[model samples]
Target: MTLLEKLNQDMVQAMKNKDKDTLSVIRMVKASIQNESIKLGKEHLTEDEELTILSRELKQRKESLQEFTSAGREDLSEKVRFEINVLEQYMPEQLSLEELHEIVEQTIQEANATSMKDFGKVMGKVIPLTKGKADGSQVKKIVEQKLK
Candidate 1:
């Protein structure tokens, strides 16, 4: 099923179960998707477009979670953590660290990237390959380590 269809189904389930958190998250995601479609003047988003929106949403929540934790706002951080979990359900399965490392290594070799100077070349090639499956920051860390 399409992401929109899945979201609609889950929204209904959340309502039936009286799951306020899940319901709110789903509504927000739906709104974001709809807004993106409207902005782009398209009735339906491509899979890549949808994935981009979901990834943006996930990134925002994770940044908020990090800020909250650093600021000692445990209550807010917990809520953001839950939101992250909800959003993750819609994302493609994440790559394990080992898998991510392997992909980065391969990309580095393909790009002939040596040392930090070829950081951009390696990252440019790697990001598209791992986009929704791996966290960009984590991939960067691994690349930096491997290059060093």
Candidate 2:
């Protein structure tokens, strides 16, 4: 099913189960998707667009979780962690570390990235290949290690 359809179904299920946390997260994601469509002047978003919105939402929550944890706000951090879990249920299956390493190695080979100077070239190819499936920071770390 499409992401929106899945979201709608889950929203209904959450309501029936009286899952406030899950319901709130789904609503936020739906709003973000709708706002992105409106901003782009499109009636519907492609799968890639939807994934992009989801990724952005996930990134924001993760960043907030980090900030809250560092600031000793355990209560807020726990809530954000819950939100992250809810959001992740909608995301694509994450790439395994070994799989990510393989992709990085292959991309580096293809780009002939001999040193850190070729970082951009390697990343440009790798990001699109792994987008939404792999975390950008992890990809960067892999690419850096491969190049060096």
Candidate 3:
């Protein structure tokens, strides 16, 4: 099944189970994807585009949770964390540091990333390879250290 199909099934399951938090997050994801598709004049998004939306949503949730915790709003933080956990259930398993490093190194070599100027090229290659499986910021930091 496609990502959309999987999401629809999960949404139904969440509704049947009365999982309010999960249902909320899943609805938010579906809406965001639908909005983006409308913007692009498309009826639906590809799996890759769906992953991009989900990844961006997860990143935003992590940042918001961090901020909430830092501000001592434990209740808000906890709710955000719960939502994040629900959202993350759909993400691919994250790669080990070793695995990410290996991919970055190989892609850098393959793309002939020669200097800091080649960061974009390398990142473009790396993100797709590591999509939903690693933190983009962490991967960028590792790749930058290796390249420089």
The model with the greatest TM-score is: 2
Q: In candidate 2, what are the lDDT values of residues 1-148, reduced to their tens digit?
A: 9999999999999999999989999999999999999999999999999999999999999999999999999999999999999999999999999999999999888887899999999999999999899999999999988888
Deviating ranges (above 4 Å) for candidate 1: none
For candidate 1, write residues 1-148 as lDDT tens digits.
8899999999999999999999999999999999999999999998888999999999999999999999999999999999999999999999998899899989988888889999988888999989899988898899899899
Model 3 lDDT tens row, 1-148: 7767778899999999999888888899889888889998998888888889999999999999999999999999999999898888888788999999999999999998888999999999999899889998999998899889
Q: What is the C-alpha lDDT of each candidate?
A: 0.94, 0.96, 0.90
Arranged by lDDT, best first = 2, 1, 3
Q: Which stretches of candidate 2 lie over 4 Å from their true place?
A: none
Q: Largest lDDT belongs to which candidate?
A: 2
Question: Looking at model 1, which ten-residue stretch has the lowest summed lDDT?
Answer: 105-114
Candidate order (TM-score): 2, 1, 3
Report each candidate's C-alpha RMSD, comma-separated, in the order given.
1.3, 0.7, 1.5
- Model 3 steric clash pairs: none
Q: Model 1: what TM-score?
A: 0.93
